[model samples]
Target: MCYYLKLKYFTLHGPLPGMPPQFLLGNLAQSGLLFDKASLPEAHIAFKQRYGDIYQFWISSTRLIVVNNLNDIQYIFTHRNIYDQGDIYVQKFSIVIPHGLISSKGAKYKRHAGLTLPLFRRGKIVSNFDLIVDCVDKLLIRWRAKSPQHLHLDIVQQSQNLLLAIFGLIGFDYDMETLDNDNDTNKNELTKALQYFLSNFNIMLFSPKILSTIYFKLSSQYRQSQKTIEQYFDRMIKQELDNGEELIAQRKRTSLIASLVGSLQQDEEMEINKSEEDRKGLSRNELLDEMRLFLLAGFETTSTALAWFIHLMSKHPQVQQNIKTELSNNNSQGLLSLDQLDSLVYLDCVIKEVFRFCPPINGTVRTLTVDDRLPETGAQLFRGDQILIPFHSLARDTRYWSIDPELFYPERFLGADKDHHPYALIPFGGGHRQCTGQDLARFELKVIAARLMQYVTFGDGGNQVNSGGHLSKLTIIPKHVGVTIDFDK
Candidate 1:
């Protein structure tokens, strides 16, 4: 099928099935369906029902293809050499995190991934197990201080505070006293900067480039916010370099920043041995960009996942009892070891279910490098055409899953969907460009869930407050995450 545009005299391939036109604004007015702060996932589902798995729409003059099939998504992600990160993401995120792995492409992305991958390896992450456990324990202590009369808690806010402390301790060697000393002005400033950047990120990403530029020029608050965030990153990067030099002198590499700095130095030495043309080390500004990306991505996704886990547990008391039973059976006690945490088999299933049910990211985008035909439909794709792999749609598609995808059943992993298609449940994406910190994220989730289950029970805070809807932004966040916490006697 093809769509002919009267104004441009151009031919476009594939189905064009959506709401009626708005003259010059072809789907731009209805852009709220896909890009709105709320109801993004629902809009995708509605579009899929009208059009097939693969459909085309216009965002102004640029054409966008939404690919919802598992096979197509797998093919695109696996062929990382053929396609690169979409221009939208590079253009939107580069201003804040220029050379970070998420925005960088080609050799730069490979270099950043190589330098940062080791820090998230199983052994390295498990080495920091005690630190993560201590953070969880501190959170639990705060909960213990609360009145035991089924106190209502905002899991979203609480989880954010807990993960910020963990990220501060592990990502950087600095202490963020947001969890303990609320009066700490430095920590408050840092937290506010991060929150401000994240809350407004989608606005910057979706607005037209010209409009955003003009707004930034006129809005002093936006400019000042960006300056504050950059200043904080600069100070943190300088501290990391100073500490990294001392650690290198002692021949000990502990933090992620130290490892990155050491790798950069090695690259410099190698470059000196070779010609100047072969230089590959990251510059100081590049290092700062990556550090900012790590801090933001690390804390935001994990904390959101934890909030969902807690909210789900509150509704499903049986799942909580099952996790507690698994903990008891595994003989967990006194700061559980990594092995003990891993042994909580039922809890693992529950975590997987939570990820499938409420993914942190809704989808990822890719820009075509050359003219190509989609393998499944044989549709023509031009160079520079943008493709979206809707993660939420694939995970919940009934065609790909054996059990009913709508139900919140953790047992599906143990039985019906044990050997499901790999791409059908990719919460962290796939192929070379997948999240580098997935191992660390999973370990943190398991440890926090286990620790929380050991000390307390979560109950639903009634339908009015606990009704689950998503607030779409940089991430798909739960609209309401209020829960009642009951301490274990």
Candidate 2:
């Protein structure tokens, strides 16, 4: 079948499918061996240029269309009915949790969202400022310690620490204190789960396409490991519910899980019950899946972003200096208000620009619910065909942003014509299923960036820092990035 003919027949508008696809592995192997390397970005860009934006692939009869146009992306994201996290890993993962915001579809998703959103209301986030501030202070302390030996910091790990602390504010009455943990209760389960996620993430990023289905089965070890983490999460949630006293009453102690389960189990007086079985809350399956989602979105995405920020800083000392100087005068003692953060014009510009160049989640996939025609080319997209949007490419595309898209230019995100396209800068994705953790991720990054700007004089870790590539799993990430921080004062 001719490529254009296929699109015409299917009533879809996309790049003509090129290359003869492999039977079992499909073009996924041509992009890179799925077993050891899933370099989709490299392939997406190359073929996107060769194939002209939207390219088609037959991955074992599952039609794949890769889209780079902003218009196509907007259409798919806006029409949520067809798109679900239908990835094999995600589908199996959902079988466990059944319906959390990440797993549920359609009506189930709506119900799950209703049950969870209240806990993250704007008011609640505002009230929790002190918790976030406290966590940043801890991160600063760790950065300060790096100066003595002039050590190389694994920012990936630091970013993880930062997020766990955020969850601590939302999870336990206590801080995770991951940086200084001596005990295993708060530290062990979370750490092990994340570590497992990190290791598994490598397998996904570099693994061959066949490993995805035939050779791949959820490991028994992964199942057992999931249980250990959930048992801990359930215990923590039970503590909060059983207390019956809101953390605000005696202390600030409320976990997201507790918040979730609390909303599920209602009461006469409306106080959430903290029962033992509820403490074991999630079914073994539920715990594993949620843990996977948490680690992927929670830590991996945010950490890679933070790592990129620091790496860019090391490369551009002057830019970092400008940020530090501005922050030094403006931090106004400690902890930035959201309003104050908004006002840090240059800092905000830098972060946005950094993401423009290096997005955390490189791309996302959405399936078409109904036949749709493209506004630009008047091409049609048929239902059930998967549209893979290479978000990073779109963000930095020369046609949209003009020449030299790879350069780190923070000003591009500022004033007048800044990232003009509504759907162009999608570090957190778009529409209903867009990442909810975006707020928390930004909050953590801003605080960490401000603190690092305050205390560290960044020096280039040189080529070793940038060459390791990303450990792509649920979230795309920079692999083995290391940096040197010279503490100020």
Candidate 3:
């Protein structure tokens, strides 16, 4: 223990502050801070109260500096070149998405990111508006079938199926009949695989190599589920390769898979003259990795956000009524267009507030590249040390917003908190590494929220069912999101 303390002192700044009487396990028990599988944000909040904005903790030999201050986070993220997604993320996510953009670095990252950027641009996203509406209409039809009963619905399950259907049609040009049929074998298998992976990911990533190997061998279900999910993606990639070009030319901007294929082909042509090391473009396996990533990320995060939004709306019925009024006032004809979706300003505020209040992802981690001192505290950071920018903490910090940050207030965006610090509310994150699909995510939320408000009234399922607490999966999910849906006549 003395030796460990001395080593920590020599490597990091002396006795780096935070909760004292360090746990015997050296914060490995608190690894949830990184993955956020528990109430890690609350723990971080407590740490901030005790130790100010910047503090250090250890997860085995690894040292993490948690930065809860807005200014510090802004500086760190803005200076993107100095930091890269940490090895912890790469090691864990690579198990599921080996060569995907999220896990790749350097020239490969640049190539993939460059190719993918065009597909997610604002205009390109807007062009898929019809596809989104079509998918949402199907969902509404499903809800209508359950209408007049005022059914107590599982918002999480409903949202997941809805987004999965949308992602299937728009993302891959594949029809995942998740909405029409509840027992989609492939969908259930994939969801199970994702859940198992997320639940066990941190342990596998952070454990010693030998122990991790043993654990992997012992967890046969996890291994099989991973293989099953990968095989499914492989099949999808093969289908795309076979038909993507013709489909792309016909549907143009509507199919994300088509765009990805087009980009891959363009890269292949560009790489023809280059040496092996100089070559850039996705191989079949690489494409499979990216497709799986898109499928999971496209649906999982958005559905979780929608679930949280529904739960919040149920809790605050007045807010729900206001959104319905806004939708009705904006589109009197009862049919929504992309232009009209954009015009529903209060709904936009509600969406923004939902993102701010219950961000699906708690935060992301970056690894330091060189020795540096924090601008605010002059705290020293050595190369390879991990920096954690807690997004939840910054958004909820009392010092940054004019209004109380804890309250579930959508009007804050429209009023006093309108001009809060730019970095204070980074729900999708900030700088170069921020989520590229944010526009698509936001657009999806608006369309769904608008459509739902137009057709159904979500009533509170009472304290037993709607009581707010989060389940920290790969994203922060609303644990108890039961709502009573009253479909309009």
> Which candidate number maximizes TM-score?
1
The C-alpha stretches of model 2 lying farther than 4 A from their native spots are 1-15, 33-38, 57-62, 81-92, 95-98, 147-153, 172-177, 181-187, 201-218, 245-255, 266-296, 331-339, 415-419, 467-469
* Candidate 3 TM-score, C-alpha based: 0.88
**lDDT for every model?**
0.75, 0.62, 0.75
Q: Model 2's lDDT to the true fold?
A: 0.62
**What TM-score against the true fold does each predicted structure earn?**
0.89, 0.81, 0.88
- Candidate 3 regions with alpha-carbon error over 4 angstroms: 1-13, 20-38, 58-62, 147-153, 184-218, 244-252, 265-277
> To one decimal, what is the Cα RMSD in angstroms of model 1 from the true structure?
3.9
Give the Cα error of residue 450 in candidate 3, in Å: 0.6
What's the residue-level lDDT of 426 in candidate 1? 87
Candidate 2, 478: how far from true, in Å?
1.8
Q: Against the true structure, candidate 3 has what lDDT? A: 0.75
lDDT (10s digit) by residue, model 1, range 1-489: 124453442224445444544444445467464445445576677678888888765544445688887777878988876667887778767755667777787766767776777667876677778898899888877777776665455677778888888988787765667678444465667677666666667655555555656766677776777678678766766665676566654432466756655555445555557643455767666776777787766788898899899999988999999988888888884458778987888889999999999988877778989988779866677888788777788888999899999989999999989999999888887877677777888888998999899888998888888887887767777888768778877
**Shift in Å, residue 470, candidate 2:** 3.8
Question: Clash pairs of candidate 1?
Answer: none
Summed over model 3, clashes come to: 0
